[model samples]
Target: MLAIRLDEPKQFRQIAIPEPERPGPGEALVRTHRMGVCGSDISGYLGHMPFFRYPRIPGHELGVEVLDVGPGVANVKAGDRCSIEPYMNCGTCYPCRKGNSNCCATLEVIGVMVDGGLRERFIVRADKLHPSEKLSFEQLALVETLAIGCHATDRGAPTDGDHALIIGAGPIGLATLEFTRLTGATITVMDMDQGRLDFCRETYGIERTVQFKGDGSELARLEEITGGDLYAVVTDATGNVKSMSNALNYVAPTGSLVYVGITTQEISLPHPLLHRREVSVKGSRNALPADFPRIIDLIERGVIDTDPWITHRTPIDKMIASFDSFTRRETGVIKAMIDVSGVS
Candidate 1:
């Protein structure tokens, strides 16, 4: 079997690996079709990802087809196309016991902690697969990423007529924008790049946008948008410490602030400001089991669009040559898809 591995930072080599054995009692052998490169993968390539290991197969956003299944596999069978939930959670942990499996104590995110599906074939637990007859392989591959945004919005619990402000217009931010729009909230987005903000307004129908500058004027612009009340919910998808810290200034009094992006550095907050506002602060991690299927259903029902989100593609043979280009800021790579099945 052919596999792409990150042997070290800034290096990727295609090598022959032993084909996976037949699925075990509760697993399935899946053929990889579409695999999306995520920000974490870029971080891993640059040695910026925390707790990430080298010599890893770097793919978790997957759309796959079942090749065969071991005994007791019932939700899907051969020829069924499905989305892979790559976050493997241990069911016996404290969070898992409370039905919060997404944050299980010993969570393993494939491509980050273990071998992932960036190969000709990969084996996965059958329970983590969610099949959708209506979604294409590309759309199916996108389910996991979209689910992240869905879970973030759900954490804030926005209602119809609520006003929400999302910072960052990258893929994750766009996903957050979509689900937030579905909540009937008048959506406004902020980003440093004019291109991204324009895409949000033109492609996603976002009602308002503010180009972020470190200057205090961006806050005033947001305040103007909300008639001085600011936003009822503020979600930061910037994955940047400075921006996350700045995002605190935009939260409305008595509103919620959900940090969807992760950063390893210690973050400081304005004490008296958040204290006086009575802000509800929360962190959103990986998505739950229910989120994947719900997102698939929404895409299937035409409630969300994935086709336009994919702006770049590469055959597996060319991935190494082209991967770095996608990371360049000027390249404007929105979503880069690797055609695993097309590898020679």
Candidate 2:
């Protein structure tokens, strides 16, 4: 079997590995069909993600076809096409016991903590497979990325008529914007990248967008757009420490702020700002078990559009050569899909 591995920071190599063992009880042997390159994967490639390990098989966003299933696995059978929920949580953990397994104390996210589905075949717990008959492999591969936004919007809890501001127009930020639209709230997107802001305006029909200039003029523009009231819910997906810290400035007095991006640096919050606004602060981690099915259903029903999402594609054999360009901002890659099966 062929697999791509991150040998070290900024170094990717193609290697041959043994094919995966047959599925064990409660598991399924799946052939990787499609893989989505994520922002976290880029962070790992550049050695920016604190939790990322080197010499790792870096892919978690997957669409796969079941080759076989072990005894007692009923969720899927051979030939089923599915989207994988790659968070491998410890079911006995406190968070898992509380039905919040996305943040399990001993959570091991595939592709980050362990080898993932970058290879041709891998074994995943049967329960992690969300089978879909109506979706293509490309659409199925995007379920997990959209799930991050779904879960983050759940945390923000935006309501109808509320003004929601999403910072960053990257994949995660755009995902959050998609789910936030369902809340019936007026959305305003902010980003330093004009191309991304234009994408939101043209693709999503979003009229309100602020080009973030760290020069304080962007704040004035946001204030003017909101009539000085600011946003009811603010979600920051930039993962930049400075942006995360400044996000509180854009929230309305009684509104909430959600941090969808993770960083290793400690974020400092001004006491006066937090105390005066009485704001609710939250950190959204990975998606819940229920998110996968919900996202699949949405995609299947045509409620979530996957057409504009994938801007780039590369075959698995050429992925090693093309991976570096995906990291460059000049590439303008909204989503890059690795065609693992060669059929797509």
Candidate 3:
């Protein structure tokens, strides 16, 4: 078996390792088919991802074909093509007990905090699999990414006919934008990248976008765009601390601000602004179990367009060499999928 490992930052090595053991009770052995390269993966590769342990096998956004299942695995079976829920939670924890396993007290996120599905064969708890017959492996890989926004939108709780301001138009931000759009909220997207903002407008029909310059006119532009009052919902997926801190200016009074993106830096907010508006602030972690299924149905039903999201694909062998350029944005990469199916 071959596994890709990031032995340390700025290094990725492929080594031949023994195949994984047969599944234990309630486990399934899956052949990883498609893996998505995410923004955090880029930061992780560059040694910037917070709490990323070295020598990690980083791949959380996965699409796998079940090779076999162990005893007691009822929902998934051999030949099932599934999108995996990669956040492993300790079921006894308070959060897990309350159906908030996305932030389980002892949560283990595949790729970020532990070895994930970056190999030919991987074992996972069978209950985490969400089988889908109507989508491709590439689209299946996108489910986890889309769910980031799904869970965030759930946290933001935007209502119909309301307005939203999304900071950052990157993959995480775009995923946030997609689910938020489904709630019937009109959206305004901000980004330093013109291409990404243009993509939001052209692809999702998001008409309002403001180019962000560190010069500090973004708040003013957003106020003008929203007709004096700021948006009823503000979602920040930039993972940039400054942007996250500054986003407080855009939320309407009594509106919600959801932080889907995270950083190691401590974020400082003005107390007066928070007090005067009585705005609610919350952090959104990974998706709950239902998020994968919800986004899967939306994609299958043609409500959310998956075609325009993927911008690159390559076999696993070539991924390491091209990864630098991928991070550098040399090829205008929106989402890059690695094909690991042919490996033995």
Candidate 4:
């Protein structure tokens, strides 16, 4: 089986590896039909992710077809089309015991912690696979990405008529924009990339976009749009340390600021500013089980647009040369999907 193996930071090799083991009880063997590359995958490849292990096949947002179901697997069966939940948690942890599997004490995310779906086939726990009959492989592959934003929206609790400011117009940011629309909150999306900002406008009907420049004038632009007070809910999906650290200033007084992007570096906050404003800061991790079903409904109902988000497509065999460019945001790429069914 051919797989994308990360031999080291900034290095990946596409090689023919042995097939994964057959599913055990409570698991299923799935053939990878399509896979979406995530920012976490890019971070792991660039040495920004501490949990990534070298020589691992890295992919988590997967669309797959069940080849066979393990014994006692009742959630899905052979020939079922599904998308996987990437977060594998330690069931006994305090958070997990309390139904918050997103922050489990010992969480092993599929793509980072183990060999994920950047291969011909893989095995996953049966319960983690969400059966979606309405979605194509390409659309279903994006469920994990949408789930990330869903988790953040749930945590941030954006209210009706509140102004929401989402920093970064990348895939996660776009997903946040998509879900926030459901709350009837007026959304103001900000990003340094004009292409992505345009993406928000043309695709999602988002009118307010702050395309930041290195100069400080973008802050003034944001303030003007907000009528001098920024958003009630500010989400930083840029995954940039500077952006996350500076997000508090953009958030309205007593507003909630959620860091949906993961970063390895320490982010500093001005104590006086945070204290004076009584701002709330929160970090959101992987998605919950509820998020997957909600996204399925959103996609099925045409609330979320998957067609435009996917900008590039390549077969699994062409990944070595294309992977780096996709991760670097080269080629105007938004989301790149691999067609594993063509893998020889």
Q: Rank the candidates by lDDT, best first.
A: 2, 1, 3, 4
Q: Candidate 3 regions off by >4 Å?
A: none
**Clashes, model 3:** 0
Over the stretch 43-72, how does candidate 3's per-residue lDDT look in tens digits?
899888886788989899999999999999
Give the alpha carbon lDDT tens digit for every residue of 1-344 in model 4. 77878888888887787777889999899999998988888888788886787778888999999999888999898988898999999899899999999999989888898889888887889999998888999888999999999888877889899989999988888888778888999999988888888888988889998887868887898889889988899999988999999888888899999999978789999999899889999998889998887788889888777899899898877877787888765478889888888966
TM per candidate comes to 0.98, 0.98, 0.98, 0.97
Candidate 2 achieves a global lDDT of 0.93
Select the stronger candidate by lDDT from 2 and 3.
2
Q: Which candidate achieves the best lDDT against the true structure?
A: 2
Worst window of 10 by summed lDDT in candidate 4: 322-331
Local accuracy of candidate 2 as per-residue lDDT tens digits, 35-127 = 999998999998889889888998999999999999999989999999999999989989999999999998899999899988889889999
Cα lDDT of candidate 1 equals 0.90
lDDT of each: 0.90, 0.93, 0.89, 0.87
Considering lDDT, which of the candidate structures 1 and 2 is the better prediction for this target? 2
Q: Extract clashing residue pairs from model 4.
A: none
